[model samples]
Target: MFLLQVDEEIQIKLLMPKDATALTTVLCANQEHLKTWLPWAVEIPSVSTYEKEIIPSWLQKFADNNGFEAGIFYKNKLVGMAGLHYIDWRNKTTELGY
Candidate 1:
């Protein structure tokens, strides 16, 4: 339940399972625009696909402290997502994905 305020109207919060549909809609609406930065946008088959599979995996990784996926909220609407992928503990590093 972490939350970061980016501004008066923008905030960052962990993406929860319940947010799947909203996130999916955002993704679908911005698919073409997002593809340039996120190749995986084209791979999503449907909204349910993310709700049932992808989001669960993200939550698990967050709980495990191996990674995190947070949603970018603007005016209470899910606009995008950002995250850090598998951390290399020995190297004390991780890759940020948004």
Candidate 2:
């Protein structure tokens, strides 16, 4: 897994299938707030969606060297997610999404 340590209380890493439940819970709790910024957040997804679809797709993206979606952890708890939508190798750029 890709991991990055931002500080004592913050960490970021590629999310695995096992993290589905925790991610689902965090999204559920923050759905209303997230909806304002993320159109897809208008409806919270099920843990199964994360496990079977989202996370798998993200892993594939990483494997293909395109980009990645990762979990944001604070104080050992999952708080949010971040990602690079895609990488433009020729342009040497990527779009950050959170």
Candidate 3:
């Protein structure tokens, strides 16, 4: 849940409709910043893939208490995105990937 950069006056919160625009902007701006570890990276126009693909998957997982996704916000704007992935509640541990 603690995704903010150290010493940064910002916070990470659940992705909301209001964050869609900023999130899209950052994703585009930082495409290179992400491609190293993110395999699904693509040169997409608009935010449809994120809205149509990423969010849906994250929402379902989060709802089932199997994941937690959030936008990294700096000064009230989304600076990046991160999440907890591959959660295994039964094992008393969740792989924290953010």
Candidate 4:
């Protein structure tokens, strides 16, 4: 897991299953504001969704090195996530999705 410190109160690190509840909190809290830009914004209903589906899939992709998802923490709380999806090794290209 990569840990980066942006400032005294902000940090960035890989998102893990253990962070499900926190991630869910961030998502739920910003759902209305995020819904316009994020298609999956309304899909997360609870931590179970993270435990059973979301986190698992993200982990798989990270393991494969195809891409990964990271959490943006502010004051020790998850505030958002940034996803790096589908690295095209041959072309050396990838897109950062947030």
Candidate 5:
């Protein structure tokens, strides 16, 4: 999977199915705050949802060379998620989202 080290305390990587529980926990904990800016955060998803659907979809996007959704980890803990929504190959550009 893709992995990047930003600094000593932070890293970014493609999330896998095994990370579902941690991802779900973090998302649910931040649901209210996230809902303020993210419409989809209005409803929190369970770990099973993430494991069976969301993570696989993200992995597929990466495999397709479109773009990818990744987890932001701090001290080995999942803190958030970010992504390059889609890449415009012809334009050599992509949009970022978190």
Candidate 6:
């Protein structure tokens, strides 16, 4: 479930495909913002890449009964992403790599 919360600052509760468009908007606009040192930075921010790869990766983790992909919001704006990657469902915890 994709959810957004607002308080002192916006806090994204979950991530979903619907949030992709907005997140990409922020990522693309700020592409160069993290390019200098972030080697994994995309040459160009594309929704297809986010959809085709990211979504599937998240689904796979979930199908395996673990982890999730989520976005980060700041003051109601899509700012970044955060989520559990490989989770230990038995322990009620997951590996979050953002």
RMSD (Cα, Å) for all candidates, in order, is: 1.5, 1.1, 3.4, 1.6, 1.1, 3.5
Error of 6 at 97 (Å): 3.3
**Highest TM-score among the candidates is held by which one?**
5
Per-residue CA lDDT of candidate 2, range 1-98, in tens? 79999999999999999999999899888888989998999988889999999999999999999999999999989998899989999999999999
Estimate candidate 1's RMSD in Å: 1.5
Q: Provide the overall lDDT of each model, using Cα atoms, as 2-decimal numbers.
A: 0.84, 0.94, 0.70, 0.85, 0.94, 0.70
TM-score of each: 0.87, 0.92, 0.73, 0.86, 0.92, 0.62
* Residue 1 lDDT in candidate 5: 80
Model 4, which residues run further than 4 Å from truth?
none
Q: Please, what are the lDDT tens digits per residue for candidate 5 over residues 2-66?
A: 99999999999999999999988898888889999988899988899999999999999999999
Candidate 6: segments with Cα more than 4 A from true spot: 2-9, 88-96
lDDT by residue (tens digit), candidate 1, 61-88 = 8888898899999999998878898888
- lDDT for each residue of candidate 4 in 1-94, tens digit (9 for 90 to 100): 6788999999988887789988888788888988888787867668987878888898888889999888899998888878788899999999
Which segments of candidate 3 are over 4 A away from where they belong?
A: 1-8
Worst 10 residues of 2 by lDDT: 25-34
1-98 in candidate 6: lDDT tens per residue?
A: 54656568978666565666786777778778767756667575468767677766776765666776777778767777787767765778766666
Residue 84 CA displacement from its true place in model 6, Å:
2.8
Better of 4 and 6 by lDDT: 4
